[model samples]
Target chain A: MIAVIDYGAGNLRSAVRALQHVGAHLQVTDRAADLEAADAIVLPGVGATRDTMNALQRLELASALPRLIHAGVPFLGICVGMQVLAEQSEEWGLHPCLGIIPGTVRRFPSHVGKIPQIGWNQVMSCAATPLLAGIPDGSAFYFVHSFYVDTLDPLLVAGRTDYGIQFPALLHSGNVAATQFHPEKSGRWGLHLLRNWIRSVT
Target chain B: MLTRRIIPCLDVKAGRVVKGVTFADHIDAGDPVALAALYDREGADELVFYDITASSDERAIMVEVVEQTAAQVFIPLTVGGGIRTVADMYRMLRAGADKVSINTAAVLHPLLINEGAQRFGSQCVVVSIDARRVPRSHPTDPLRWTVFTHTGGAGRATELDAVAWAKQAVELGAGELVINSIDADGTRDGYDLPLLQAIASAVGVPVIASGGAGTLDHILAAVTVGQADAALAASIFHFGTYTIAQAKHFLAEHDVPVRLV
Candidate 1:
């Protein structure tokens, strides 16, 4: 069973609906035991990195997540969930994150189109990964974010997209993976990605 | 690159879609969920549901419709029309709405924008402004339009200028702005391009040009000439005048960037 880690930072209703539609047996929970017992884990979040980090800490999952990822637990992070995996974020002035990935999140420059790139944009696969299996190279995904992860390690990049500047849209290392866009909100291509990830672990 | 978004706005009264869609595949033309699913199949980037009903009983039905629609439809769904306070936004979000748009409420208490953004994150708060062009008596007035509170009904014009108000709304943490042209609402001549351009240029966030889309050319004009990030329409798509696929194909052919399924 897949465990969708929820800490009151974002909407898990759509995520649950999307995953169930893909025939994945998953439970949305904030418990540490559930995360440890699950076959695979999906961390879903939205809103500010500060709030998300705080919630994860309050639930006592902040320190536990890095150890789980290091132990090779199949994991997927969405939007702000992916941002919290980074070392730190500049949103509301330098908040520390979980450091599962060696990177810092930075706001997209104001000169680059709009502050929040809130629309469909094409993402191209940068590295081969099971999480992105069967997904096209340049498929459009729904994105609503002002900040993006700037990975220090280049090999972690799995998918990249362009708004004004090219930013990492997807990342993968070992069994851990993440996407900057909301695959739950993206149409069939998104569902396909979720199915691919579930297929990998199941 | 981020492409232009084409949104089909569904006006829902009670639990039914106000303008019946003509899609033969849908079970009921007035069913909002069925229409929304058909639009999703037609490759619509996002869907907006405007609850036109005002009564408390009807509002509950609207929430139920939102829950059912969000369960089936995966794309971003924005609910507008009756959202008044942070509590109203909370109800919509809990009901599975991705975003809540406020028009009169945002104008009445500007703090509602800040409060909603603070609670739900800035990505979910969209301040919709209904504005009409001012009949000019003085040539030197920089303001071309005044903000209208009650969907631009006569005697509803406020002291706020459309462009200035848009900039201020963004500053107060509105992630996006919907500029509705009152003069061109149902007439469908075209979008108020000058009004759209003025506000789109002033704001750093995405601006959706609402009201007055008669044809595919008008949609093209809204994005290209008016410089809007998205074009929203109601009657054209609902009456089967044009499909979202056809509009997107036209945009792609004209060199405007759009997501083609």
Candidate 2:
């Protein structure tokens, strides 16, 4: 079963429902044991990265997540979930994250049109990954966040999207793959991407 | 590049979708869940469900409507109307709404916008403003509009400057603003371009133009002339006067970048 980590993030229901619709046998759990037993893991989140980190720490899933990813367990992170995979974030203040990916989460500059870039923005694929197999490059995906992942290693960057500056839209490395956009809320292409991820992992 | 959004707003009352002319003379459309699915398939960028129900007892039905619609619709869903507190926002978001839009409550409390944004990020809080143009005293004076609330009867005027309130709401943590014009709502003539332009230019966040959308040109004008990030309409989509695909196609033909399915 795919374990979807639920650590009091906003709009967990939408992620859960979308996963279910895509034919995934998943369990929404806050327990580490569930994550350990699951074949794959999906960490879905909304809101600030600090709040997500705090909740993950409170639930004792913070350390387990990095360990599981290192153990080669297939993993997917959405929005703040993807942000927390970075080493640290500049949102609010300098704070350590899971450190699975050598990167820092940075806020969009004021000239990027909007602070919390909320709408459908195009994601251009950088590499041919299974996560974006059938999905077309430059397809519009629903994005609702203020921060973007600035990875240290450019090879791990699977997709790039532009607002003011080009930012990592999808990150893929070893057993872990993450997306800044909410694939659950991106309609057809979003669902297709989820199905592609599930197929690759399963 | 980010594409301009085309959203279908469903004015739901007592679990059923309804439309009105200037917020009166309601006409039953269809089931919200079915219409939501249809719009999703028709390539609508997003969906907004405004619960127009008056009684608190029927509020539960709106949650159910959101729950059912979210199960089938994969796109972003925004729920507005009757959201008075953080708990009310929580209820809708918990039931699968991506964003909770608060209009009158945000105006009345003002702090509710901050509280909601603090609890669930600014991206989840959408402040909707219902504004009607105030007749100018002299021809030399610039165009002016005031905010209005409680669209149950004739609507109550708040006498707040719509443009100033747009900026203030963003400062108070509104990730987005939906500027709905009462003067042009349901008239099917066109959106109040001056009002939309004023508010859109006033705020940095994405502003969705609501209340007036008659033809495909009107929708296109929203982004091009009105400077809105999104155009929202009810009767046009509900009555099958135009499909979401047609709207996107028209916008794309007119050089406005849109997601075409």
Candidate 3:
């Protein structure tokens, strides 16, 4: 079973439906027991940094996540979920995050390009990670964000995407991994990613 | 580098794509899903689905069409017409619409943009403004334009300046703005450049200029002279007269930087 944590930020149903489409049985809940019992847990979000933290806290899943993740449970984060894996964020102001990865989430630098980067962008796989099994080096994924995670080690990035500055679109460390772009919305490329994630644990 | 976009606006009503001449003379084009797939393959940077039938019965059709289109095309999809609240925006996003564009409902209650942006990201909220030439009382200056509601509006007040409205809406958190000129709608004469330039200059967000695109040169003029990030057309695209691929090819040769097929 794949547990998709729904803190009510936004777009949780899409994640759930995408997992189901890939033939993965999933439950959308923020409970610790359900998360621990599942083969994998997906932290999905779509909003500002502060809002995402507030939603996780309101559901009391902020502290429970570390416990499940540390237990070697396969974990995948999507979009804002990828942001929370960092040390902190500058979305509205500096806010503490999950700290599963050593980095900070900051807004993209000012440029002539659109702020949101709202479209299908190519993601180049940089490392050999199980999370990217069958995915090519230049697979287009759906992305929509003004902020991205900046990490201390480039090796943690499995996939890098270019907007204004080339940044990591997918990151993985041990049993934890996250994708700034929504794999659930990235068509065949996204489905391949989810299947790889499922194959990792099950 | 951010490339200028060429968009095909599909007014899907009851699951069918209906394009009009001047927001009238509606004709059935094709299924929304098929048109989206074609646009995706033909190099349309993005696709916009305006729910012309905002009626309750037609809303279901729009949602179904969106789900179908989402499965087929991976390009950005902007949905408009009938989006009134945050919940409505959420529903569309879940259905796989990339952006939710609100027109009359947004201008009527500008805070809707903020609320939608708060729940979702600003990137997901698109505020579309329908403007028309205010018909200068004096012949000296014919550049005055005012905002209107509904399709091309009907005796509504043209008091609001499009630039002012776009500025305020962006401040309230509209990620992108789509401006349509009533006088230029389906005319094929050309986009209202002065109006587009004013609105684009006033707002920092990417502004999409819509209306009066008959030729590929019209798109070039809108992107360069009008200073818009994108040019949107319906009739030329729906009628098979000007394919999106050809338009992008022409714009690329002319150095407009549109995303190519």
Candidate 4:
């Protein structure tokens, strides 16, 4: 079964709906055992870095996340969940994150047509990964964020999305993977990509 | 780079989109679901639905319309008019509205914006303003624009500043703001560019210019002078006078960075 970690984040229903539509076993919760028991783990998150990280700490999923990623378990992160893979974030002051991948999150400067690019945008692939398997090269996925991650190792970037500037949309390294766009909300193409994620592990 | 957005708005009353002259004189545009699907196919970046109903029965009907639209359209949908409380916001969003807009409701209780923003995050909260120019209030009269509600029927006297309110709303956690000029609403005279420019100067978020929009030149004027991120129109789009494709083309010709439909 696939375990979808729910740490009091946004749109759990949509994530669960996407998983069910694609015939994926998705048990949504903050429990430690579910994270350990599932064939693959998907961390679905939204909102600012400080608040999300705080919520994870309050739920005690902060420590569990790194352990799961380190154990070679196939992991998929969504939007803000994808950002936390970086070393630290500058939103609402500096704060540390999961740091599974070597990177840091920074706010997109104001000149980029408002702060949050809230809508569907096209993403270009940068690296090969199973999580992005079968997805189109310039597929338009739904995005709603003002912050982006700057990864040190560019080779791990599986996909790149451009708003005012090009930013890493999806990152893949060994068993760890993440997407800056909400595949669950991207309709059929999003569902197909998410299904491939579940299949990669199980 | 970010592209300027062309938005089509549908006023759904009793589970069906019925366009009205000003606020009354309602007429059936079409089935809400079918119209939404058509807009999506026509390449609209976002869709806005204004529920002009006053009571709970009509509000329930609006929810049904939202459900149908959400099921049919994949693009982002924003709903306004009658969203008074957090529960109301949740109902629309749960039914599949990408965002919920509060206008008269926020004017009555400005804290409602703060409360909703805290509960649902600012990303989902949008403040829709309906401002009318009352000459008696004078050019220097900060309250010249009377914020209207109940479809421009009722409004309370206020010495409050609209610009300050917009700034505070953003500070209170509103991700986006929509400035609708009641004076220009349905006038087809063009958008109140000065009003838009003022709001854009006051806030650091995206502002959508609504109300006036008669010709293609109006849209360009709004984008260039008004500095609005998006332009929303009802009659023009609902009546099929100007398609979204045409609007994008006009914007592109004006050297504006509008995402082509």
Worst 10 residues of 4 chain B by lDDT: B20-29
Residue B182, candidate 1: how far off, in angstroms? 0.7
lDDT of 4 by residue, A41-75 (tens): 88887787788888888888889889988998888
The digit string of per-residue lDDT tens for model 1 on A5-36 reads: 87885478888888888999998889999989
Clashing residue pairs, candidate 1? none
Who wins the DockQ comparison? 2
Candidate 4 residue pairs in clash (backbone atoms < 3 Å): none
> Which pairs clash in model 2?
none
User: TM-score of model 2's chain A, to 2 decimals?
Assistant: 0.98
Q: Candidate 3 chain A vs. true chain A: TM-score?
A: 0.95
Q: Residue B29 in candidate 3 has what lDDT?
A: 43
Which CAPRI category fits model 1? high
User: Against the hidden reference, what TM-scores do the models get?
Assistant: 0.97, 0.96, 0.85, 0.85
Give fnat of each prediction, in order: 0.79, 0.97, 0.22, 0.16
Off by over 4 Å in 4: A18-25, A110-113, A120-122, A128-141, A162-165, A184-202, B20-29, B134-146, B152-157, B253-255
Model 4 vs. true fold: TM: 0.85
Question: Per-residue lDDT of A1-202 in model 3, one digit per residue for the tens?
Answer: 8888878755776677667777788888878778868888998878877877888888777888877788788899999999998889988879999888889999989872667776567787788888877766676677778899999888789889888699999998789889998887665667778888877767
Which lDDT value does model 2 have at B210?
Answer: 92
Candidate lDDT (C-alpha), each: 0.90, 0.90, 0.81, 0.79
- Top candidate (TM-score): 1
iRMSD (Å) of candidate 2?
A: 1.0
